[model samples]
Structure formats: C-alpha cells, structure tokens
Target: MVDEFLKWYFSQRPVLASQLGADGHDHTLGDFSAAGLTAREREEECWLDRLSRTETPTLDDAIDRDLVLSHLRGSIAMQSWPEWRRDPSAYLGPVFASMFNPFQQRLKPEPELVAAAISRLAEVPAVLAACRANLDPDLAAPLLVQRGLGQARTGRNFLTRTVPSMVEDPDLRARLAAAAEPAAAAFDDLVTFLEGFTCGGTWRMGEKLYSTLLRERELLGYGAAELHEKGRAAWAELDARMREVALRVNGTQDWRAAMETLMDDHPPTLEDMRAEYEAETLRARDFVRERELVTFPEGEECQVLPSAEYARPILAVAHYLAPPPLSSSRTGVFFVPYTPDGFTPEQVRQRLRTNCRAQMPSIAVHEAYPGHHWHLSYLAAGSRTARKVFRTPYFTEGWALYVEKMLHEQGYFDTPATELAHLDCRIFRAARIVVDTALHCEDMSIEQAEEFMATRASLSPGTAQGEVNRYCAWPTQAPSYLTGAIEIERIKESFTGTPREFHDRIAGSGGLPLGLAEQAALA
Candidate 1:
C-alpha cells in the first residue's frame, strides 16, 4: 500500500552524500520500507503517478489547498534527491526549491494566523541582517553563502505563503495596503522551489495527487489538532516537574524565589559562552561514546559552528546541524547564537554552574553530543524506507530529552552546579508546555504568552519573545520535547529494577513512538 516512488526517492540520499552510509553501514531511510512496499515486482514497477495517487489519511479542514500543494512539493523535490556528500549545491538547491512549490500554502487561514505570519516575515531581513553583520564563525565563505542563499529562498517561500494568506484573511486586507517589500520577498522561496525542484509525478493535480504527498513523502498521519493536543499534555507534566526541581535547587520554601535566584546568574561574553557550551556538549559525546551507551556510527564527527542567520531565530541558543553528507563530509556543526551584552557572562556562568531542578546539562545533552547529532547520525546511516517515511519528532526529541535526565540520574555530573543546570533545562522545557498550550489551544495573545514565559518560565524579554514566535511558527513542537522526555523517564522508571540497563536499551528501540516505547520499556 505504500507509495513505491517515495521509497526510492528517500533511498537516494542527496548529492551532498547519498552514497555515504554511516561508518560504512548503508542506512538509507529506504532501508526500512518507507511505503511498507517490500514486494520486489511492485517496487520495481511503480511510477510517480501511481505512487502519488495512493490514498492517505484525511487532511484537516483547516489545511488549505496550497498547504496540500506544499506537501506535493516536498514529494517532488524529494525524488532524485542528491546526497549531501555527493553534491552540496544540489542538496541546498533542491531543499530550498521545495519551499515554493505552491505546495503547503494554506487555503483558509484564520485572520490571526495571517497577521502573525506577516508581522514575523517583515522582521526576517532586519533580524537576519543584524546576525550576518555581527556573528562570527569558522565555516568557509562558500558554506555561509550557501546558508544565505537558502535563507533568501526560504524568505521567499515565507512571503509566498504568508502574503497570499494575508490577502485572503478578511482582517489583513486593510493592513495589506502597506507592506510591499516583505510581500514581494514572500514569493521568492516559491519561485526557486518551482524552478529548481522537478519530478515526473508533478504532472497531475487532484485530491489523490496532493494527498499522496502528505502520505508518501512525509508519512505524517495526524492532523493539526491531534498534534496540538499531544503537545498540551506534554507541556503540563514538564512544567509540574520543573516547579518541583526549582523548589529543590533553591532549598527554598517558595519556587518563585528559587526561579529568580536561578535566573539572576550573570551572563557571559559570546566566545566564553560558546566555548562553555561546546565543551559541555563534547563531554556529552564522550559520555555516550565512552560508555558505549548507544550505537555510534563511525567516520562522522560533530563540530561546533556559529549559528547561521537563517536558523538563528527559532533554533536553540546552541543548535546542531548535521554534516553535509556522510560520503562527502564528516563534520557536524553546533551553532551558538550571539546576542548583545544583555547576555552577560555572569548569567552564562551561573547557568553553567547552578544546581537546580529543570537544569542545563539536560539541554547540553539534548542539543549536542549523543542527542540530536547522535541520533541523526544513527538514522542517516541506515538505508531504511520506513525510517525515512515514518520518522517521528517525538521519538528523536524524546530520546534527546531522555538522554539528559538519564545521565543525571546515572550520576554523569559530579558537581551540584552542573547537576542544577541539567535540572533547570528540564524546568525550562516544562514551562514550554504552558507557553505552547496557552498560545495555541487557549488562544493566548503574543503579549500574554510572553508574560507567561517570562513570569512562569523565568525567561528574559528577548528569549520570551523568541519563544512566542517559535510557538507560532512551530506550533505543537515545543511540548514534544517535554512529552518525549517524560515518557522516556516513565518507561525507564517502570523498569526500575534495571534502570541503567533499561536506559541503555533505548537506542535499540530505534526511535519508536511512545506507544512502542511502552512496549520497549516493558520488554
């Protein structure tokens, strides 16, 4: 029943590194059966049309025709995908082009969705320009240019999607009279995607044609609301646990005071802060490798890079970018963002040193080392179809979150300050539950959400605002972090008699969902 072409498309990898199997293991996502198509004759005979027209789960009403188009675009771009190792330019080109494909443009957005997307799109150039001028890094000029080009294309797509959405929304019709530049730029990403990415199946237009994308390419089964609710429950539990940790760290009767004390630590200079984070991340990598805790594909390496402008806003303060491609490159990047003196050294130092619940080490574990980069490498090396078609954010993110808590309970950090940072990270994520749920489900205004983040999560104004917009663009993603982490913890606890070994068995589960995690836990 799985679309056959989609399976082949995912298997090919990118020009950057399609052939570069992880540490010599040929782990293409196709290796696992993306469409669950195992029959040799069927797999060999299927073309894009037959594959694309395959039935899929019903899309939510809120999703417009354009949005569905975007899914089609993804499917199209994915076909003949270049492995990053084999061709970087091709990889970047196709990825960016996919953004425009009239694929995924929403047909009927609420007025607020239109308004917010517009407002944020306007800020892109300004925010990005500042980052480009100020941030420093070691990546070559070619790479930076590639990133900038990708952003330019992405910016275009942002406009293509948002501008029309604005014109369509009754409320934004009045405001649309003014914002010309952003509106123009919005169409940029689309133009590129349309021109650059092409596949045979794109020749048709119909419900089946569009839905095939949602099914074949992404393998995403749920609707917007389903994902949203999943995030809500996750946020709640994380917040509850974070509060408990704050109380413990403060040794205080009141969690509110403990939170204040935790945030009061002075900030750090960009270099020192970046260095500090990088070191911690390295330690995490060593921990996982040293302990032989999980399967680490050889050959690929993780390196710290300065955060690129395109990813600066929503990406974490420090982020992990996978290597160019396994065949061509061995280095992964951890991008650290730079803000002004507002991010003081003292605060950075305190965060690094503090001992509290909802700590920072958990973050380091998740962001670096044996977390994002680690698992990404794990999946990238395999040539499994199901893995590519059915990858889950909850599965990967949950594992990352779990890594932090698992290390802590396992006593990876000797210093209480280090321990506290780990707890604080959890606390912050817990708070994401409230922030994401309130903003999305409760229809909390940006200002209201910002206030919630600042007051409840103990974030600064800049960070709080960032969280607000991130929730808008990403929707239910934030809550997944906590949900996945907590679920991992619960599963481990259920097997308390063998927590260490049980925890060690995590990677073996191979990024299964919580439903499967439960089975894995019991097993």
Candidate 2:
C-alpha cells in the first residue's frame, strides 16, 4: 500500500521526481489546473482509505505505515487552505524547480538533461496559465503578491541568462535558448498578472487553524500560544547570553553595537566572502572529525557556491541545498548570496554586512559541516523512502541550529565574536517564532513584524523585510529553527550516552518529527 501511494505521489509531482534523481518524468510539469487538482485530491482520498485499512506484520512495517499516514493527513489538512487558489507563489516553486533540478542534478548525459529542461521550459506557459486560472486575486494577500512578482522577475532573468550559460554544447545551448524565450515570456506574463492584482486578502491563518497545524501537521506537543510564549522565553534567554558575549567582545553590554563592530571586519568583496565561507566549511568539517563530534558517511562532500540569481531575493544570506537523496553524488551546495543587479549602494552594504566574517563560522557550521549537509548525508545513505520523502521541518532545521550550539560548547567557536554571533542567531530564530505566531495568530501587521525583527533581531531593514515576507508566505516554517533546537535540547537532557552517540542516533533517524525521533533515540 505504501509503495502504491508513493508511486502515485511521485508520478503527480514530476518536479520532485527530477530533484530526487528519479527519471522518466523530467519532460513533464505535473498538472496544476482546476480539474487536475480535483483529480489529485480524489486519488489522495482513495490512497488514504486503502493505507488505513492495510495490515502491518512487524514493528518496522507499522512505523512505515504510520509515517505514510502522517504525510497523507498533513497534505489533506493543508488542502483546506487551497494554496493554489490564493497564493501565486504556490505555482512559482514548481515552475522554478522544473528547470532547476534537471539543470543541476547531473544524473543523465548533458544532452538528455538539456532536452528534459527544454521540454519543461516549453510547458511553462501552460503552467502559468493554470496559475492565472486557479488564483483569485481577491483572495490573495498583498505581500504574497508582491513577493511573487519579485520571484517571477528573477526567475525570468535566470531562464534567459544563467541557464543558457550553463549549457556547454552549442546544439543543446541553441535548443535551450529557443525554449527559454517562451518560458521567459511566461514569467513576464506572471509578473504582469501579479502587478495588476490589488490583493486585499488577510495573511492570517487565524488562531484555530494555526493551532491545529502546530499540533496536527507539525506533530508538536504544543499549540501556537504556547509556542509563542516559548519563543519569547528563548529570545530573552539568548538575548542575555548575547549581552555577556558582547561585553567580552567589545567591553560593552550593547550587543547590537558589538555586532556592528564585528561587521566592520568582513571580507572586502562578495568573492572574498565566498572564499571565507569555503574555508570555514572545510575547517568545521575537519574540526568535527578531529573532535569525533558526529560520524560522516563515506564520500560525503559539500561545495560552497554563489546563490542562484533567481533565489537571491529570498535567500538574503546563505542556505544549504542538500544533494538529491537518490543521486550517486553526495555533494550538497551551500549557496551564499551576492548583491543583485539593481540594488542601491545601501542595499548592497546591508547584503554584505549580513554575511560578514564574525557570522561566517556559525553560518558555515549551521548550513554545512555537521549541520544540514552532514546530517542529511546519513539519511541519504540509509533511510527508507517513507522517511526520506516525508520530512518534519523542525527536525531538519532544528538539528542544524542544534549543532551550532553544540559545537560552540565543544569549543569550535574559539573567538568571543563567534560565540556572540551564534547567540545572535539563536535570538533571531527565537524572534522568528514570536513574529511568526504574532503574524499568523495574533494579528501582527507586516510593517510591525518587520520593525520587530529589525530592532530585536538586529537585522538590517532590507533583511528584515525579506524575512517577514518569507514568514508571511510560509506560516509555521519560520518557527521551526529555534523550536526544533529547543526540542532537541530537551531530548538530549534525558539521554545518558556520550554526545556523539546522541547526535549520531538522532542524525540517523532521517526527518522524523522530534517526538518520534526522541522515542527512537531514547529507546
């Protein structure tokens, strides 16, 4: 039953299939039209019914069944919101991925990959037309529309310029270029649609649905109000810690001032900044091995690269993109953002300041090394399809955040500024939980959230705006980082084993929710 469901699921999500190195579906963009979604929902219901009735003979079988059930339930519950009907951004993700996965994952020969990309590109107009047909601008949130426009614009740039340059063979390049023109035009049409929208919809998910998602979908022990309170407490605790580290760094309790002082010592240019991050990635990997912090799977590798031009708007600083689990390559890309083409001088300064030297060590540890790349590598090697495909964001995001603090305690962060930077990051995540809940459940406006982030998290105004825009679009995701770390720490407190054993146990659990992962770890 599980196998049947997964096959159907992957069949309907070709973009996902491509990303996971699954072939045979790369030439198509899965259905997004109204009739298509209705058909999908009907099929989903059928699968859920069959899976619920199926019998499992062993403990492992039962666990797998439960995982599939959880994933199905979450998908059904979220269907109530009808994201495709309201958010234009909903369509952009798969649109971007359709080309991105085929281009990046070298699973096939270059010509074949380019052929797949061209096919997907040809489908772009139809996909955008479906987006227009399904989306009700009256139900769209203004901020969501605005951000979707930004993404559309950059996506157009990526297809026209970056994608063609990536092709080496002249024949394939010509084919890709021809296909890209219509695809780029599709993005422009999307941009026009979004710009014309006077979206009046509320971004709020409301207290009831938000709480339900926190408890049911996220598999969390607490609801929105409790999570918000926890976030406030965590923020306060981290803020106090930051002040102490700040005093050590600059002889003052003004943590923001200390952060400014550290920012002044950043790399001279974006290229230099990328070099610094590369060095830190290698350095942290070595430190982890020397300290026996966690186990590394054989042949694991991570490469630091500039952020893709299309993703820089949302990827304000740096992030990790895990390698395809089904691919032979174990290399993950760590993307560092560069200043965009039209950024004002001040905007460029903010972009550079956010990636400054003092923060690089902690960022490197969180996004690469024993954080995301290292943890995900273990799962890629050994996890079942159920675990690999169905992820709990808190566990994934939290584990990354957890390693930052864990390594700090292990003396990996040798400088006071680095420690200060780690604490500031913690505070930032904590603030995310607070701001996220406030925006979705407590009726905080976008402007207020941006202000809160800029002042409390010590983010630049532009960075704060981008962060808030993300929070608006993705309801519970922002809170996952800090909340996940907090949950993992709680789980650690109950373990009697060495740190490495505990870390390895949790890392090996794939993307299970914290509650399930804790049971697996402590059992």
Candidate 3:
C-alpha cells in the first residue's frame, strides 16, 4: 500500500522525484507547472479522501504508521491553503527548483544532463502560461507578488547569465539560449503584470486554520497561543543566560553590546569568510566524532560552496542542501552567500557582521556537522522510501536546533563569546515564533514584523527586512525551528537513557513529527 501510494505521489510530482535524487524522470518536469488552481485542489482533495478510506496495514510498526498518517494529514493541511493560487512565489519555487535539481546531482553523464535541462527549459513557456492562468488576481497578496517578481528576475538572470556557462556543448548551448529567451520574456511579462495590480488578498492563515496546521503538519499538541507563550519563555530564558555571559565577558549586564563586540570579530573578507566556515565545519565534525556524540555514517561528507545567484536573494548567510535519500550520492552542499562586488563598504560590513567568528561555529554546527547534514545523512541511509519522501520542518529544523543546545550543554562553546552567540541563535529562533505567529495569526504588518525582529532579536535593519520578507512569503515555516526544538527537548526529558541513546532513538524514527516521534520513541 505504501509503495503504491509513493509511486503515485512521485508520478504526480516528477520534479520532486528529481529533487529527491530519483533517476529516469530527469527528462520531465512535474504536473505542478501545468495544473490549474481548481485542478490542483481537486487532486489534493481526492488524495486526502482516498487516503482517509484506506485502512492502516496490520503489520505496520509504530514508526511506519506514524509516518503514513503524518504524510496524509500534512498533505491535506497544505492543500487547505490556496497559497499556490494566491502566492506567485509558491509557483516560482518549483520553477527555480526544476532547473537547479538536474544540475545539482551527478547521476547522469554531462551530455545527458544537458539534454534533460534543455528538455525542462523548453517547457518554461508553457509552465509560465499555466502559472498566469492559475493565479487569481483577486487573491494575489501584494507583498508576495512583489517578492515573486524579485524571484522571477533572479530566475531570468540565471537563465540568461549563469546557465549557458554550465553547458559545454555548442549545440546544447545554442538550444538553451533559444529556449531561455522566451522564458526570460515570460518572466518580464509576469513582473509587469504583477506590478500593475494592487494586492487585496490576506497573507494571514487566521487562528483557526493556523491551529489546524500545527496539529496536522507538525503534530504538535499546543495551539498558537500556547506556542507563542512557550517561545516567549524560551526567549526570556536565553536572554537571561546571555546577560550572565555578557557580564562574564565584558563586566556589563548588556548582552546586546557584548553580542555587537563579538560580531565585530568577523573575518576581513568574503574569501576568508568561506575559508573560515570550511575550517569550522571540519572542527565540528572532529568534535562530534572524538566525543562520540552521535554515530557518524561512513562516506558522508559536506562541501561548502557559494550560494547560487538565483538563491542568494532569499537565503540567509548559510544554508544546507542534503543529498537526496534515494540517490547514490552521500555528499551534501553547504551554501554560503558571498559578498557581491556591487555592495558598498558599509553593506559589506553589515554582511560580515552576520558571520562573525563567535557565530560561525553555531551556524556551521546547525548547517553541517552534527546538524542538518549529519541528521539527514542518517535518514537517507536508514529510512524507507515513504519516510524519506515525507518530511516536516519541525523534525528537520527542530533536531538541528536541538543539537545546538545539546552541543552547548556538552561544552561545544568553550569561549564566552561563542556561548553568547549560541544563546543569541536560540533567541533569534524564539523571536521567529513570536514574529511568525504575530504576522500571520495576528494583524501584524510587514513593517511591524521588521521592527519587532530588529528590536527584539537584535537583527540589523537590512537583515530584519530580509527575514520579514521571508516570513511574508512563507507563512508558519520560520517558527518551526524553535517549536520543534522545544518539543524534542520535552521528549528527551521523558527518556530514562543516556543522551546518546535518546538521540539514537530520535534519529532512527525518520522524520516524524515531534508528537509522532515521541510516540515512536516511547514505544
């Protein structure tokens, strides 16, 4: 039953299959680009109804049952939102991903890869046409539409400026260039159309749907109000800890000032920044292995690379791309955004401040060793197809944040400055919960969200704006990190075993929601 369901799911989302490291589907883009709004909703409803009618297999274990149920519920919850029809950025993601997925992996020869990319590129016109038809002008959120325009511009630049260099064959390059022209024009048309319109749609999911989303997608028992309260408490606790550390470091009670001093300790240039990150990643891996914090998978490695041009606009200072579970490759890519040459000296300083020496280790740990790359490597190696295919931000992001705390407790942050940075990271995540809930569930405006993040989380004005822009474009996702981590910590407190044993149990449970993970862990 699971196998049949997976096969159908993959068929409906061929681009997803390519992203997951599946082969043979390389030549085709998915139905996502072509499906109209009504058709897409209908398909989702049909799947939900069908899954509801299907009986759970009697032989299924706790983890298997949890995985299956979570996937079904999460899919239904996602489909309940009209984000695909309302948010242009929603469509832009899959379009950009379809182009990037094929090139990211080395599953095929260069010629075959170029051919697949060309094939996908040729469908770009039809995809954008479908996108234009599917989006309802009445339901378009102005903020999201503007953001989508930015993304489309990035995608256009990628097609025109970056992609040709990636193709070697003269014939393939020519074909790509020809296909890209129409696609780029379509993107221009989209931007023009979006700019002419005024936004009337609300970005808010509202309290009721927001509650349902938490229950279904994250499997969290808490409501939005409760989660917000928890987030506040966590923020207070971390802030207090940072205050203590601040006193120890600088003989002042002002943690924020201490944080600023630490931020001033960044590497001098972007090249040095990359080199520092690489070194920190290695150091983290060594610490994890030497102390036997968690079992490391053999042959699992991560490479630090500069973020792709199209992705840098929305990406933070650093992010990770885990290897596809079904793919033969075990290597992950940790992408760090480099300083663009166009940036002025002040802008460069601001960027560097975000990647200070005190903060780099925490970011490295969260993105590379004993964090996303490490946790995902285990899932890719040990999990079934269904488990690998279905994931939650809570489990993925939560585990990474949880490990950050775990490492701190294990003395990973040896210096007062690093410890302050670690606490600051947690505080930032906690703030995300407050800001995300307020922005979506309350009547918080984008400007208000930016102010809150800047004042409370101590983010620079530019960084705060970027973060708010992300929250506006993607609702509820930003808060999952802290929420998931809190749940994991609660589950850990209930365990009677050692820390390693607790971690092993969670790791072995695939990417189940915290509620489901707890149930499986206890079972």
lDDT of 3: 0.78
TM-score of every candidate relative to the true structure: 0.55, 0.97, 0.94
Greater-TM-score candidate between 1 and 3:
3
Task: List, residue by residue over 103-143, the lDDT tens digit for candidate 3.
Answer: 66556776787778778877777667766776777777777
Badly placed stretches (over 4 Å) of model 1 are: 1-3, 7-251, 264-267, 290-292, 313-316, 324-330, 340-360, 388-390, 413-416, 490-513, 516-523
**Model 1, global lDDT:** 0.48
Clashing pairs in 2: none
How far is each candidate from the true structure, as Cα RMSD in Å? 16.2, 1.5, 2.1
Whichever of 1 and 2 has more TM-score, that candidate is 2
Highest TM-score scorer:
2
Off by over 4 Å in 3: 32-37, 57-62, 168-175, 339-343
Candidate 2 lDDT, 330-432, residue by residue in tens: 8788888886778887887787788778889889999997999998877788657777777788899999999999999999888898888888888999999
Flag regions of model 2 displaced more than 4 Å: none
> Cα lDDT of model 2 overall?
0.83
